[model samples]
Target: MTSRLKRTLLALSLAISLPAGAANYSIGTGSQSGTYYPLGGMLAKVWSDNIENFNMRAEVTAASVENIIKVSSGQQLVGIAMGDSVASAIQGQAPFRKPLDVAVLFALYPNVVQFIVPADSSINTIADLKGKKISVGAPGSGTRVGSTAILEALGIHQGDFKAQSLNYTATTNALANGQIDAGVIIGSAGVGAITELALTRDIRILSFSQAELAKVHAALPAYSGMEIPAETYSKVTAFTAPAVWNVLVVKKDLDPALATQMLETAFGNMDKISKVIADAKNATVDNMDKLQGVPLHASSQAFLTKMKGQ
Candidate 1:
């Protein structure tokens, strides 16, 4: 074969082997029992089913902190995290020794700081937590960081409140067994565990009223104010609480086309996701700006902005 013809044929063959320009991606989410896991699975299904060349898959791995490590290592194309946690990852704040390379796609919704006590415990306020055994949050999860910060801000340090780093399920069990004074979980109000616990026992979501939220934001400016809707859980009739945004994060260097395709699919099929997890109904183009933790990915920003304009 002539050299020129051979080169042309090789190029054609390579192009043929490719998926006509589709970029498959994976999203790293949290544990199976947590909200992130199911949400990730739904996104993956919608993306693979609708977006061309986008065969996205979701992995139920460790939450935020570990997600940052996975995405930075190029092992995952996307991740879900609390906005504050994202700030810590990129800025190399506590829990992370060095900065990471990650960017934001969009903000889904608020992940509130929920501390469920036994409903009969003596602890009634943040101050009441003093010298009491509290499950701050799961290790490496964003809740842990917020729990620590809130406690410290209230003048309750590690010594002030006994810290037990436990996941939502474990902490739930502990709270019911009277083994722990309080359990901390950072997620949307009516989150699986928190909602169920509320149904079984009267649980109250600790409020960091205007004064308390102000104190917290002063230290970690990344938190954007959030309001927990009325009657989010079964037992509780109404409670509006302050919270931070939970964001969809991705590797900074991801292919632009893939990012665009993924966002297109996600916003396109949000209704389907809403069926499984009703809270996801809030995931829309308008709310995406809530993710200021990292700069918006160009492709996602463009798609979402254009959708907003329409």
Candidate 2:
């Protein structure tokens, strides 16, 4: 064949083999040690593998607040955010300048609030945290937002305690080194940081009193009381704590059809995801009821309606 014809043939072959208009997307997740990160990675893999001409990756982020901002700005295609953060953002609450255009794809799982302190510490209850140094997660993390709300609801205002904004790993380290008196972590039941800390040092998971939980619920209706099963972490017993369901969200302008495809792909592969992230087992069509306050993506509403019918 002529050299020019050979080049033409090569170009045509490449076109035939590669997907037309292939697109790359990213899912914004939390710290490397958090549940969101691994869940995001699993999603990226399954979505990329199942979707034609689409590539997806999981980006490590500061979690909910940052994820919401980045997803709204189109920096990331999707994000996992706590329901409380989503509600606050939608209402143009603090840390967000104005209501952002974001919609939920589906509910993931409940992020249980875990109050960690040295096992033998004198801090016995939420009220005892007064005047104590506490790590309430990173500045842009949902843990920070939710923990603050919880503390304030119980009359433990910022000035009432020395509040520190640190990520999960940092919070764990600070606790181990006696840098903080207590740390508030809102994550999946088997959160790596808390689990690792429990293994190396004796730690306690504090529970809320009925009145305290009632106060929190009255102040922030988005939070619900839940239990962290015994043995979920070593050296810890079952305890009741506040929890907020985590939701997968996409930007408002994302294509409806694409959103539908993504949801279908994820729900269809729940078995595979659950194998990797135990919390994923709770990510089901039935749990769609858990997602509240946030507007559902048009595609998600339709898809969920169709699934519930079947």
Candidate 3:
């Protein structure tokens, strides 16, 4: 081949072999059986497809607390976390040695605190959980943080109950096998684990009384009253529960332009994301107000403002 022809061939080969300006990132998600994992996967796919040279992956993590620490410490690019945990981290709470610098990308959905028990069990109220074997979710998980806070608000300290930290799948299995009296699952309605558990065995979701809810709200102001609608799970009736919004977060210092691009890619593809996770339909510019405590990432705030004006 002529020298000019050879040079042209080499250029073509380089173009095919190297991805110019490629950017790789991972989204820290929760357990495989939980909502965060699937939702994170969907977001990664959509963002990857829409953003030029952007490759994103979903990583299974210990959920909220771990996600926050990882993202804030620059170990991960982004993560999904509970609003309460984000607030706690900002305030330098336990599990967080000191305040973390993080910013909200957007609100995902409300993670309702589901206190699940066997349908026939007599444990109808939060007060009845005293001294019972309970699964308070996995270590460093949002479920654990919310459960511990709710229980403490009700005057049920650590010693008042037998606490077991287990993942959603293990919690369901243990409950099914009569190993634990109840399990605390904090996720969007129709969480996969709870749905699967309800398929084989009848289960009841205990509700918080008005008085109990007041105490909980007083303690954890980030939480608000929410009702898990009737039949959200098989044979489980609607019940009042405390819920906190789940949010996508990124490091505070992420590039404003890149952050805006990420938000645009995700928001523009909401239809696709909602098809995969029904709760994702709630992730809209209007619902940005649902995010509590943490400030919105500058790019996200600008994006929302732009979306609103349009």
Question: On residues 1-310, what C-alpha lDDT tens digit does candidate 2 reach at each position?
Answer: 8999999999999778667798888999999999999999999999999999898899999999999999999999999999999988888998899999998888999999999999999999899999999999898999999999899999989999999989999999999999999998999888898989999999889999889889999988988899778888996888999998999978877898889889889999999999989999999988875866778888888887898899
Instruction: Estimate the lDDT of model 2.
Output: 0.91
Q: Encode model 1's per-residue lDDT on 23-65: one tens digit a residue.
A: 6678888866679988988888887788767667888765888
Question: After superposing candidate 2, which stretches have Cα over 4 Å from the reference?
Answer: 1-20
Lowest summed lDDT across 10 adjacent residues in model 2 is found at 286-295
Q: After superposition, how far is residue 279 of candidate 1 from its true place, in Å?
A: 1.8
Give the alpha carbon lDDT tens digit for every residue of 1-310 in model 3: 8999999999999777646888788999999999999999999999888888888899999899999999998888999999999988888888789988898999999999999999999899999999899999999999999999999999999899999999999999999999999999999899999999999999999999889888989999988889778998888899999999999988888999889888888888999899989989999989985876689988888888988999
In terms of TM-score, how similar is model 1 to the real structure?
A: 0.87
Q: RMSD of candidate 2 to the true fold?
A: 4.7
lDDT head-to-head 1 vs 3, winner: 3
TM of each candidate vs. truth: 0.87, 0.93, 0.93
**Which 10 residues in a row give candidate 1 its minimum summed lDDT?**
234-243
lDDT at 262 for candidate 3?
89
